[model samples]
Target: MTEYILLAIIMVFIYFVLIRNKPAPKTDWEGLPTLPEYKEIEKTTTSEGELCCQYCGHTETIERSLNSEKENPNKNKFYHACTNCKVILWRSEQS
Candidate 1:
């Protein structure tokens, strides 16, 4: 009618701006394989002894200090070795 309603409003604004501005289909990450460098492994104490969590096997009896003889009010009894998941860590304010 008015030139077919101005060619259906310019084909509905070119189908909503160039087919909705299509650009989203590109993710290969080029093979994607490079993630392995978190090595701090030297854990040994499980012949029925306790203290385990080498990245979460999670056994635990902990709290050791049979007196290396330093009579103190609480030097926190020192059993520390967890610099990011090396896991020995038993000085929780001495109990």
Candidate 2:
């Protein structure tokens, strides 16, 4: 009777501890490829463009100063070139 009881207690302990669903082991990432911190952007685009040439009625090629804005209080603030005319289209500040 006592032997049966001891065996039953041992089985119950085994069922709760060793035989029960064990916790998943920690991952060993020694040789694994590391993931990027950010989801990389795949597309590239630009909003900057060339202004229409007023003289020749043609579009001019892109230059660094073509898409830039400047600040000047006294003289011309915004100046644009027109084709091969060599004339500056001076634009004033508009509210």
Candidate 3:
């Protein structure tokens, strides 16, 4: 009975040390820092159908697609993101 009690105590110690003490998993969004204030210099369209940020000179393509479920199913949709800075310039779907 004393041996069983010793085993139980060992098991509880291992559980607390190895399993319960683990740190929480980090997420992708958590690592990204907030961007500072920056001015948008110019806007231009590329031949490949991408918007260019004149301030950072980063070119990013905005995705275009038709939403079949909407009333205007043929309406174009896309979100713009700077390739270099990874800043989201514009987003069509607010929600």
Best by TM-score: 3
- Steric clash pairs (candidate 2): none
> Which digits, one per residue and each the tens of the lDDT, describe model 1 over residues 1-95?
99999999999999988998787653322122211211223343345655454555455435444344544345544443434465443333354
TM-score of each: 0.22, 0.25, 0.35
In Å, residue 80's CA in model 2 sits off its true spot by: 49
| TM-score of structure candidate 1 | 0.22
| Cα lDDT tens digits for candidate 3, 1-95 | 99999999999999999999999875333332222212232344445645566446566544433244442244544445677776655534322
lDDT of 2 at 27: 32
Query: Which candidate, 1 or 2, would have the higher lDDT against the true structure?
Result: 1
Q: Relative to the true structure, how large is the alpha-carbon lDDT of every model?
A: 0.47, 0.41, 0.52
Q: Write the per-residue lDDT of candidate 2 for residues 1-95, one digit (tens) a residue.
A: 99999999999999989867597653322122111211121211123433444445444422213233322333333334444665443332323
* Candidate with better lDDT, 1 vs 3: 3
Residue 88 of model 2 has an lDDT of: 45
Error of 1 at 95 (Å): 51
RMSD of 3: 10.1
Candidate 3 whole-model C-alpha lDDT, 0 to 1: 0.52
lDDT over C-alpha atoms for residue 15 of model 3: 100
